[model samples]
Target: MKKYAFAASAATIALAVSGQAFAQESDAFSTALADGAVTELAPVTVTTPLRRPTTVLQSTSTVTVITEDDIEKSAAPDLPSLLKRYPGVNITTNGGQGATSSIVLRGASASQTLVLIDGMRVASATSGTAYISNIPLSSIARVEIVEGAHSAEWGADAIGGVVNIITKDGSTCENGASVCTTVETGVTYPWGGYGTVSTRGVSNSGVNFNIGLSLLGTEGYDFTTADNSVHEDGRDGFLQGAFNFALSKDFLWGRLYTSGLYVRSNPHFDSAPYADWMTGETVYGANEADQTNAAFKVGAEVDHSDTWSSVFELYSAFDYQKNFRDGHPEADTHYDTNRYGLSASTTKEIQAGAALNTFTLGAEAYRETVDSSVEYTETARDVAAVYGQYGLELDALTFNAGLRYDYDEQFGDAVTYNVGLGYELVEGLTARASFSTGFNAPTFNDLYWAYDGSYVGNPDLEAETSKNWEVGLNWAPTDTAAIDLVYYENRIDDMIAYVSDPVTYIGTMENIDKAKVSGVRATYSQMLFDDRLGLDFGFEYRLPKDETDDVYIANQNRLKLTAEASYAATEKLNLNAGIEYVGSRWTNADNIEYTNYAQYQLGAYTLVNLSAIYAIDETANVKFAVENLFDEEYQTAYGYKAPGTTVTLAYRRTF
Candidate 1:
């Protein structure tokens, strides 16, 4: 689940899902507060993950936080590329930038993981995937990644986990400043450039507001190789424009706020068309896609005390896309998916002797609809849910438990729950464990799409479900050093996938079989040399297996390792370097015909990046970065060429 913070006063406010940049004198992934430092962050979610105010160390689930400083240092132009640096995350893209991508968190498929921007959904119902490539990095301030099942708190589509992105609310201006604005521009390799402008201000009447704008475009390279016989090869291009707006006012009763983000992207991809397909000859076409993504929310928070509060909100989000092909207008298709919802919740805290206890109850309702060129049996579905949670913090023990009941118009009813506990074995060391259950609803395209030439839909598909078991430890023996390790196993039942008949080769969606994933993730962070140099290392080993076939999962890596270092070489220069390694993976789901499981595999590779920032003055700086310094050739999938070594140079100024 994601949490938001509401300022008690109008002057001190930040609008986001979670986190504060530079708040972590420690590892930003764990807790934000440093040793003996004041936790002066906004009042609520900058430290919370389960809807109430608490530090990251107090959370029972496996969590990772990427602050604004981390984002700026990565120098990644797209969201997917930036997310790959963290542990427990694996990315698989169809081609180069602006191509479709799958974010497999803890071995969960793209459709099973939930993504939120400022606590609202932006994924398409048809494909069950978010267009993360369309989300500009300039619009984000922080990101939180939670692993394992969490349907008890967030509802469906959380069978795997959740990714919550928080954007700037403009509270980071100079002390007591009434208005502030910043402009940034960059030129990147492989032919691309971008620019963004952001401003945040508060009025004397206690009305706060923020506005941001960004534009980006790239002249990409050929996505496919000549070895494939599908079509001709050429360059692909991508362009996007986006905006963000937020407004809030302090009232005597509560704080009222409204916020939204909108993005329009035009992307070109290699396709087969133009020439008549009935001729049975290969034909190349100039193809492009137009995509629109938007999300908005209006809400109010009322706080009577630090631990007692309530909130009410209404939200709407949608993702629409239409494709264009030369001389094949009739073959081009479009999909429009929309969602609208409302929620209300309240939390109460009680003090009994030395123990603090809290309880929460909430209810939510949402409707989803799809409009497309294909004729389908169903077009709309509705969902309603009620949930309750209880938490206890007594002495060295921390505990949490939640239960939820949901009713779906298409899938009937479901109930999920989780219980977790953390115990302090020593002054700075803690051990924790949890058990949870989650579910994922089948998309309309999977359940009711009309039959096409090669693909069809089955209406008997069930909502995929999962159960997870986890245990971990957090050790912070010193202020500058920290270690976190966790082991988790998740089993999914009735997993949904498209199945093709061996004889006819006609594909239809169905409940394939059972699948399981088990893994261990570990991280170590330290600072040295008068705290001027920082180092962080992360490693993950996972085993993804299909219970039905007793074979390894396809395209899921078993090993991943990363190392990052940052140093202040001088007063004016800051340097950062990183290295990442991903293990080889099989590209085919079935390997019965292959020998020693060696055929149809994507080889492993290592990538290195370097970045530097030189301060021209107090308010100005220049950013220079090199990605894939060695230009290692690799592919996430068959017949697609990954990006090569590239360089990016940029300038930034603050006012």
Candidate 2:
């Protein structure tokens, strides 16, 4: 009972330090939505006859692709809300939309699971995690998710794998000249409303472009039930405005492109926890932040020949925040970061009797500068990296190898690599295996941050690394059916853990923990009734443990199962439903208080969702959806109540 009470009080503390960052690859995550009449139903991310319809990222055989169609028909309001419905993913939110959230992929925390928006990495240097909730689907084109590590190509941050976000662009136009507009509006059960206007076109001059504007606001419910010394009664609220644009043109020998995404949001949260802790006085009311995220990129892709190509780009990105308490500026705080980078890569393919060979070489350099209310010893850092890759394909076997070296001004030298192979075992079955190494660097807060009595920094912290191996099988009995089964293990060494003295109340970071994760993932997709009905299923079981503490990782479930069904009720009406089941998880990894009792467990929970889209015409449609169809009362985090049953209605049109 004591432990439960303490756990609840801890919820408020997370809101402040819980801000996170995400590392992304040069890739995508096949996202979630109602239009996936057949998601992950292909030999790769899609079935044959389908080459992802959209803008960037190289397609991989094991990735999952959620195309533009899926984004268009999605009923969920935010990305994280819908992400939980996919395989190898688990999500926990502080409350509703626009609130702080957490994502764990294949036992790797959010910081470990790389996040990329158009092949660009995004995250706050101090928080070490990405804020993805404010990115609306209205401005997106496609999302691809890869479940393992790609640090060899994406740097230390891609330790867990990658989730790529591709925004809307005119590059996919059928002809050299075309234009289209999409208007969408919707209302939610929490009494929120949203509207979006997006346009894309290619002109006669060969200038391709995409532009969009969106607004969303809601009277959200109190995001937490935790009780500190204060009381919060009013409903929390959320408001956001977003803008996106992309322009590109192809020349006889090359192509030039530029894209940008900017979003600003003010989300109300219960800051009573922090108020009482800070002022030692009773405070009541909703707290909020003027938060912003921005990214811009300009690049050129040169096609030297049919079998040779190269890409070079310059990019800049940042995350900003200013917190306000009880609508008063007296309690405000700020954190802002800026990053600029340059990258270039070239690929060459050649034919060698009976085998096709491909090679790639790339290099990149980036700098991060920070401005915060708290002064630190170091306010800037630089990273330079170079990498190479090779691939070979034969009649029955395929292989790939990659190597990368990085030099960080603060952390010094590090190297990473990956190797994988696949071979056909029978007419319809194939064996696959891979071995890889990856790492994650300590965040700015981990190494620098002026001493403030309670906590201090550790300039000696080292980078964390991982050794992983996996074996799997892919079987396609027929064009209409596909199956994948894999089992893997990962050992994370030099984990940066914070240790503190109980009596002195002083905390410091140290690389003293080692972690291990082993799991099995299996997925099956099949087409039924002549493709009118499609079904996809995924199952994963994992054991994420802390080798040093001799215990399992906290807040992570050991088993997860998911299923999705899409049915074309008629030529004009489509129906889709999804179900997710997550096994119980431990609430804490250790008993810091030594209460002589084991940790409590959050009970298992399941969610079911239903949605239907009725086409009014070729260019317009109406959508109705019900989330938490069963209203299962469950909490992904202790002391926090997840949203209950909610309904939504939306209308969309394209021309």
Identify the candidate with maximal TM-score.
Answer: 1
Return the number of clashes found in candidate 2: 21
Instruction: Please write out the lDDT profile of model 2 over residues 457-485, one tens digit for every residue.
Output: 89898888888778877665655455677
Candidate 2 local distance difference test against the native: 0.72
**How displaced is residue 419 in candidate 2, in Å?**
0.3
lDDT of 1 by residue, 1-655 (tens): 0011110111010111111111112123222221222233332243334655565555677777776666776756688878886778888876667877778789988888988888776778888988888788888877877788988888888877888887777564642468878789999888999999988888778778889999988898887766544444688888899999888997766799998899999888877545556987645443788989999999999987776889899999999998877676654778999999999999999999999998999999999999998787899999999998888989989998999999998878889999989888887677889899999998988988887877887878788999998998877667556667889999999999778989989899888788999999887766566445667778899999988888888888899998877766776777778888999988777844466333478889999988888878766778898888899898876777778877889998778
* Estimated TM-score for each candidate: 0.91, 0.88
Model 2 segments more than 4 A misplaced: 1-62, 171-177, 226-231, 273-286, 591-599
The lowest-lDDT stretch of 10 consecutive residues in candidate 2 is 13-22
